[model samples]
Target: GTRGPLAGIRNLGATCYINSLVQSLFMTPEFRAHILQWRFEPQQRHAMNLAYQLQMLFKRMAHPSRGFVDAKAFVDSFGMGTAAYRQQHDVQELNRQLLDVVQTFIDKAGTEQVLKRLYEGQFYDYKRCKRCGSVTATPSPYQDLSVAIQEISNLPQALKAFTTPDEIDGVSCDTCNDKTTVEKGLTYRTFPQVLTIQLRRIDYNRTTFERERVRQDVHLPLDVDVSELIEKSVVGSPNASDDQDENRFELQTVIAHSGTAYFGHYYAFTRVKRVERDAAVEAKRLEEGEDATEATVGGEWIKFNDERVTVATPEEVEEYIDPASWKRRHVVHATKKKAAEKTKRDAEKKKEADNNDSNNVNDGGDAPKDATEPVTDVATTTTEGAANATPSGNAGMGTPVATDEAFAFGADLFDNTGAGGGGDSDAVAEKSVSGSSYYAIYRRVDLPLPSATIDTASLDVPEYVLEATKTEDDELSRDAAELASLRSVVSVGLVYRGKKHWVSCKPETTLHELTSTARQVFGIEDTLHLRLRAFSATMSVLGATYPADFTMADTGATPGSSFTLLGVEATTDAAIAKDVWPTQSITEWDRLMPIRVYQPEKETFAYLRDLV
Candidate 1:
């Protein structure tokens, strides 16, 4: 049976299952490794404590649902339940034990030695600051080196058999040592350290493997012509070998140690060049005024050029190429071609016109009678009358004929509408017979006149007129007045989603009631959500310190009211009391007083504020 408060809860079966799950979740290899790396470290202790607290809080709040409860019950009823719990408990205990062991190993190994081995045999080319004139210790002691090597090698096996390879690189100097100082006079020394190991296979590079395979399969024939082979290689011929005569390889390795610790072990291989002189020449040129230039030989170096090499002046170079002169010559040649084409076209047009004139002269000479026909007096009078008329045959000669009206009538006539065929015959006849009419004869003839029909339906009004009418009937106008009144009552602006919200309420209204009214009137259902979030924030703050009273009110003049924000004050008090005292004090009145006070205050403020 469990001891203390959990004594009666013992043998409940559910408790054991919960404990096992918690242990399994928290005592995994990854979690252990993380704890080992950071826990107890002065810099990381606060963060670790926060994480642990949050985890415990989350677990306490989580209520196992129906499925999880059912599963737990079934498992607990089985005979294997006890064995599983034992296994998880044993693992948890073992992990805790290993943590102490790891710490001991780290203490014995020494951090300085471990850091040095991490960069062993690597080309670090350490340089000392000229001002400080500090040089790193050469060849750290053998005892420290062996301890570091032993610790690192044993770590892989010690970490609960988690086989995933990991590499970490760390650098620490005198400055870092000063920064990582511990309590007391002892200082935490720092040195550069790096560790490299594969963690997990997240993805694979198939393309890289295929390319490597292709590269290995390539071969070249020894008997082939040298120049032909070169050309074939440059042009990417299928028969050309990728592993040609020029190929070479380079490899590098390094081992290092620090005070009682292994720093690192590293190895690498890369392609090397056979023509050492070529590299020398490039290096020399780089040092001199000459820019590094590629050899004329066709290969990777074909496109390379020496940008630093000075040659001819800009003017001299331009003279040599003569691009401007060439452009001018090209323009002159194009202009001459265009001129020739234009002259040919003009000559063709003139010839065609001369031929047409000669044909007209011959035809007229052959038919002299047709050309000499005279006009009769009636025809002359008719022509003169038509010219003087309004063209609509209307005798009302005062009626004006606008150009647009005349054109429209012409268009209608072409479209076969009779409106343009002739003006009103009766009116024209009446004007023609009138003895005093100056345009009597002209009125008798057909003419065009403006159409009298008006299209009143086609007129359009501007959009601003409709908008203005809508503005006159808007509900927002009333809401704005109410908001103004609410603002006068509240001192602080009401906020929703980080923006100030205008309200309409009387002064002395509580924030809680105002929020409720705002929700109903403004359809702001999210007000409750906001309150809950604020309550959470208040609780968090109260977890550290308890305040005297918690009241919420809209500072806006509209619908002014105060609502005693409930639960927050009590919740805050509870959290602070719990954290500070290690246990809660029991008093029925103590628990209920805060709630009772808050509820009445909320109701009173809400009621009085709404009256406004």
Candidate 2:
């Protein structure tokens, strides 16, 4: 939805499923960059020419040209259905085919190819026999890992579930040379530069004999450790100076499927990494002699729904994955408080005025009009026909009533319309309501705002010393705000899951307050775990915690600078700061093994997530 030329893809029927797959791959910056450089050096790059077609199609997709790129050739190569029929295709099926194309393309281009550098990974296969207890090991190459979802709620749990060993009976073992009980295990031998974890949401139902889809919400973390899944052990230091043995992965693009197996829609939410750029240029404005504003750019997450693209917040992206999280938090509005106060004050003032007027007499029925009164109390009617007609009830409603201030105040409140309406008339006969003197009475009726009291009970302060502690805390909060206002302000954006979002904040705000504010903004109560990532003009900082002691102004972030607010699990009951459970090194796996994905040559997801 931002300022960009958007491109649309023609539905072409059930092709929407595959369209989601294509869009997901196209948005991966490294992969797109590799495809853009396709020279087709090898003519038979992947025998079916799948890679060449993909490069051409993706290039067109990235182009700013208006019309939909012809994806017919690319879709046809998959052999899902008749070209003319245009039947629906499964996303995972198309996903595997696309990987095969890339893998073969890399093979044809040899070891030095772009696809090979990005997609190739080594995996180890281990099988152990119960008879002799000898384990056999083998290695194989992979473009991606298809991990079963297993109905787990999070990525770490799903990967853990996937790595569980399978038991097989009556299997011939090389060591035993006879049929025996054996266990088969698959673990990561190496990690690809662009590691893709396919959530196997589709599974077979034994009773129904049909492919069933899983709709349960599954959570993914911003940081995940797959080192436990590695078959080999770290040859060097586990926590090396470079920290590669950690083998952590950051979420990049998510291809979310929203429908059942028979019918569904596909869209993607992608993380746009930061790059060094000037705000003046990105904003398309640069005043002469204006100081240049530099920034760590691309801290935004955008959603691609077919051709329609829009910016999304971290909360929105989370809600997209899990529908239950979509409920928004109720807001505490300051205006509503003011309105409530005004209402109460007016009601009290009205009661007081009513009591003051109750003791006066109404001339025992009808009285002669006073001469000095510029406004009339009743219709002339020859002075009410000299009271010849019947005298109406003095206290009756809808009668022309006069306030004591007809002459004392002004004529504006008299409702001096051509028709002799009273001062309380709905219509203003002479002066408009704005110019009327009624506001004078309104000012008199308004009472002062009452002093606010600190809720000691909520603070759990004992009644004996409640007054003493409440006074101290309240004074500190007020004085802190005033002092913080003296410093310059820093604007921050919340970065969570796979997205970065903008949030407004005052200058001199500290991280502890920031966390509380974010909780309110996102409608979270109780425990909220948030970490701030600050970006400077040239680079971004990592691991900034929000403590009450430090203010954002202390971090040296620019006014228009971007920050990433990463959401973490809120822990209770003995939470360790680092090297804790789940994230603790290599213990969760059934079998201990070395981390295999550490390589300085290829950049991993961990490096990208922390990219300055």
Candidate 1 lDDT, 375-430, residue by residue in tens = 34554454455456675556446334344343444454443326656632222111
lDDT of each: 0.27, 0.50
In model 2, what is the error at residue 305, expressed in angstroms?
1.7
In terms of lDDT, which candidate is strongest? 2
Estimate TM-scores for all models: 0.12, 0.45
Global Cα lDDT for candidate 2: 0.50
Model 1 RMSD, rounded to 1 decimal: 41.2
| Per-residue lDDT over 560-582 for candidate 2, one digit per residue giving the tens place of the 0 to 100 score | 44443433323343233221222
Q: Model 1, residue 409: what's the lDDT?
A: 42
Q: In the order shown, what is each candidate's alpha-carbon RMSD? A: 41.2, 32.5
Misplaced by over 4 Å in model 2 are 1-6, 40-49, 65-70, 76-85, 102-111, 129-133, 168-181, 233-246, 274-299, 320-612
For residue 489, give model 1's deviation from the true position in Å.
Answer: 99
